[model samples]
Structures are given as C-alpha cells and as structure tokens.
Target: DHFVVLFPILSRNRFSHILKGLAMSGRQITVMLSYPSDEVGNHLMDLDAMYKANLNPHTDVLSRQEFRKLFGYTFKHPFTGLDYIDLYMDLAVDNNIEVVLANDPLAALSYSKDVLVATIHDRKHLKNLLLNNGGNTIIGLDELATKQGKSGGYNPEFGLLGSNLAGNNRLKLFPRDAEQFCYAVQKKLFEKTGKTVEVLVYGDGAFKDPVGKIWELADPVVAPGFTAGLMGTPNEIKMKYIADNELVGLSQEEAQRQLKQKISQKGTNLLGQNASLGTTPRQLTDLLGTLCDLMSGSGDKGTPIIHIQGYFDNYASE
Candidate 1:
C-alpha cells in the first residue's frame, strides 16, 4: 500500500513512532515536508546558504538527493546544531520511505492518493485541498484520537491537536472546558472584590526569536478562551510622543507630571492624534498572554498562575 504523510516537526521520537506504525501496516510511505523550515519554524537548512544558492522554495520541488547536493551535511541550526533533514532521512531507512520537499499541498498526490495531513493549524485546509485534488483516504492529526480512550486522556473537541508527550505512550491533552473554567474564575473574582477581571486559558506566545528564528507558537492558538474584557485589540497611545512633542515648552519634571495627566485623561479616544502615530494595535489577550508567557517561561520555574498588577494603571497612578 502506498501512503503519503505530510510530516512536520523535528522530533526524533515522533518520527520513529510514525515510521514504526506505517511499517507495521506494511505501507510504503512518502513523507512530504516543506523546505528551509517546517511549519513551526524548525529550520531544516541554513537560510543564508539557501539564499546564496538562489533557490526559491516557493517554486522549487527538491528531492532528498538534490537538497543534500546543494546544502550538504554541513548546515546546522545556530543554537541546537540539529541536522534535521539528515536525521529524518537516516531514520526513514528500512521503513520504505521517500522524502520530498515541496510547498504545495497537491504535491503529495504524486506519490500516493492515501494522504495523512499532519499539520496543526493548517490541518483542515490541507485536508480539504488534498481531498478535492484526487486524494482517497485523507486523515488529519486531530482525527487520530477523537474517540474516548479507556487508557489515555483525550480532548473531544481538539483531539490530538494540543497534546504533548508526558512520557512513553502517554500524552498531556489540552485542558477540557477551558472557557467554562475561565468564566468561573472571572465570576468568583467579581463577586469577591466587585471588580471585573479577565481570565483566559493560554498555551503558546505569539512571538518569534530574532537570534534563533524560532516561532514560539507551537500550539494552535495563543489563548483559547478569554473574558469579554479581554476582547479586541488594545487602543493605546505613544507616551514618548506626547512627552516630547505635546509637552514642548515644559521642563523635565513638569513634563513627566503633564505626561502622566495626559495619558490618564487620553482614555479610549485617540483618533487623529499625533501622539498615537506609531503605536500599533495588538489583541489584548495576545499582549497579556505574551507577557505571561515571557514571565512564566517554559522551564523549571513551576510558576503556574501569574498575577498582573498595575496593568490598567496610568503613569500618574501611585
């Protein structure tokens, strides 16, 4: 049987597991991957070398041999020194595998009609594209664990979308009823202090590292659920612009006090104001979620809940 799997991620364990399963089924698999980098920015080749080679990943469909000849085995990630493409290729032996590098979703149809859509956010769209374009047995990562299992945890809504490896043969699924829990917390806080608080279930940050070029959004979304107070992009003004331009005649200390008053009184009205010129609008949840993610990093801090104070406070506030 011929099966085409659109593989993403650089995890050796996951690669081995998928190959083992496919081999057990006696399926000769063709694993298609995007070039330069995978979907979540796990880069496969040196970006500088790719640019130097004048290879357009948008149009170029590269075989394993072609990629190796051009980039060679010398390209490694700056921080991790991972030769991901070579690693994946080495692991595919004896599994009856042929790896292809292409950007288009329809490219997998050349190898086999039976396709496995393994992307996270692009799974639905990719499945539809494959099915409409001569695909026979199309499945996604989300559908792999939809049903309730007697042994392991399962998310009925998300399925295997937001799962992570806790141990061997064990996964940590996304928290169930996250929206309900957030609402409950908000309600409890309001009743206790008579103040409205926004609560949300956050996973990954919406950010990228300049040095490593690693996009931090491994999860599907930054935040799944948030209170109404956390809805929409933040309307903020540039305090520096106001302090410099608006308070032109004032001295250092006087300008500080005036700036504080101006920011506090500026409120939600910022149309046609020069002070709000360069300020970009970002979603409130994304902003707060990024802050929380940065504060409580993906390390051994063990800090779960983050209490943000003075967020709503102006420069004038004590």
Candidate 2:
C-alpha cells in the first residue's frame, strides 16, 4: 500500500523466484516492460507485426488490455517459445501488481512516485532519471544486498544486478575485482611461461542474433577489465582497400612488396583514414570478446575458458 514498486521485467528467470515474496509485501507494484524487445534484444513480438498494427515503440505506451488484444493470446518468443509478457503477468501472485509497456524510464512516475527500479544495465541511469523527475522513493535492484553477509550471497559492487538465483534466497553474483583478477591471471601466466601474455575478464559479448533478434550482451559489458596491452581500439589499415586501390595494376609479387612497405611506413593512428575504411572501428576487447564468446558458446555447449592466440598480429607484425 505504501511502496509503489516499479519493476521493468526482462525474462522469466529474472524475477520469478521473488514474485511470491514480493506478493507478501502487499505494495502497489507497477511493472514496466519494453515492447518488441527488452533491453538485451529479446524480441517480445515480431517487428513486422508491430508495424502492421500501426505501433511506434518510441512514442506509444500500451496497457495490459491493449497488449493482449493486439498481440493475441500466447505471443511466444521466437527461440524460447515462451510468452514472456504472459509469463510475467501470470506470475503476479498479488492483486497489487499493475503492468505497463513503454521504453521511457520516466513513464513510471505516472503510476507512482515511490518505486523500486528493477533493471540490470540501466539501473543507475534509470534511478537517477526517476529521482530527477520527482520520484519520492527510488531504489535499484543492485542496492538490494550490497553490504550483506557472504553466506547469504552478496555482491558489494553489482549487488543483485548480474546475479543468478542459487535457491529461493541465495543469489550468485558476477565476479568482483575484475581488473585485479586480470592482473593476477597475467602474473600467473608470466610465472608459468616466460612469455608475457595479456589477459582480460570478459562477460557476454556485444553480439546480435539475426534469427532470434536477441543480443548476447545481457550483461553490463563485454570486457570489464584487461591488461594495459589490450587497451584502446585497433589501429590497422584495410589490407583489401590498400590492395585494390593503391596497389592496383601492379604484379602479385610487386603488390605484396608495396603492401609490406606501406604497412611498415604507416602512421601510428589510423582513425578516419581512407586506408582504414574497411577495418572495424571498435574496441579491441569488444572484437576479441565477440570472437571468444562465439568460440565458447553459452549454456550446454559452453566451455568455461577459451584460448585465443595471435589476435594482436597484423601485416606489420613479424
């Protein structure tokens, strides 16, 4: 009655275990959901379907009645085949629960001022946005078990943001001191082998699935920490562009020699250069993380660790 909780649900596993416990609170809970897809790119409905029905995700907000009517019963996910909307709403153990569909963080204020923000990646920003927009009580899910004891399972940094439910109560959180861990691993690798190998702590990669329309980046970031060597974006020229344009009409051997010479004589920074046009202008970690994540697929086919070699090698490298 007093607390008007604002929960933005992602999937079944995100809030299923706590639904009954929240019901006991008897708070006027307002659940906000992003339509077509959640924050992590889990598509709720097909894009064509939404467009055919004359809906704009940017401006339009849908009530429970409208959502059900438009999408029909059991609008299943493309991959999981679970109707996430129906699943979430059905799990509302309490009559106090109310659902709304929107992308705007400020939309929660229309229902209540006192709200509990339940999002993962955008928790801090959303909380701040709510506070700035006249919210009475604003709390992020990450702030839940920040300083709690370890036996009960607690994360001082992420709290419950990147946590998995071990039981009805216990939540296994994302690893802490990621930067320190990388250094430690680097040190251990140096100790074991004479060569100095750079290390990084990578979570889910920033990869999008064309089939499911879901992004693999459900976590906060791809790489939270890495050695000094793995810092900054890749600074390399486009070999294909160089070969086709600059080295055109030359013999194969001559073109190869010219390419090697160009590589040797290239400037340190290659950002916004015509020679680097075809190259991916992104963080090295992001690229590596995507590659590594693909190598070690999640769920059943997952291997806990992936070994990558020669990633830093370029045409310039001997």
lDDT top scorer: 1
lDDT of 1 by residue, 1-318 (tens): 888878566654334454444555666877888878878777778778888989888878889899888878887767667776656556554657777888888888888899988777788889999899889999976676667768766676766666666665456666667888899999999999999887987877888988777777766677878888788875667887876778888888989888777777775867567878887777888888888898887679774888887776656777
Superposed on all Cα atoms, model 2 deviates from the true structure by an RMSD in Å of 2.5
Candidate 1 Cα errors over 4 Å, as ranges: 12-25, 52-54, 89-94, 187-196, 251-274, 316-318
- Candidate 2 CA-lDDT value: 0.75
Q: Name the 10 consecutive residues with the lowest summed lDDT in model 1.
A: 12-21
Estimate the overall C-alpha local distance difference test score of candidate 1: 0.76
Candidate 2: tens digits of C-alpha lDDT, residues 61-94: 8998898889886567766688766666665655
The pairs that clash in candidate 1 are: none
Candidate 2 positional error at 55, Å: 3.1
In terms of TM-score, how similar is model 2 to the real structure? 0.89
List the global CA lDDT of all models: 0.76, 0.75
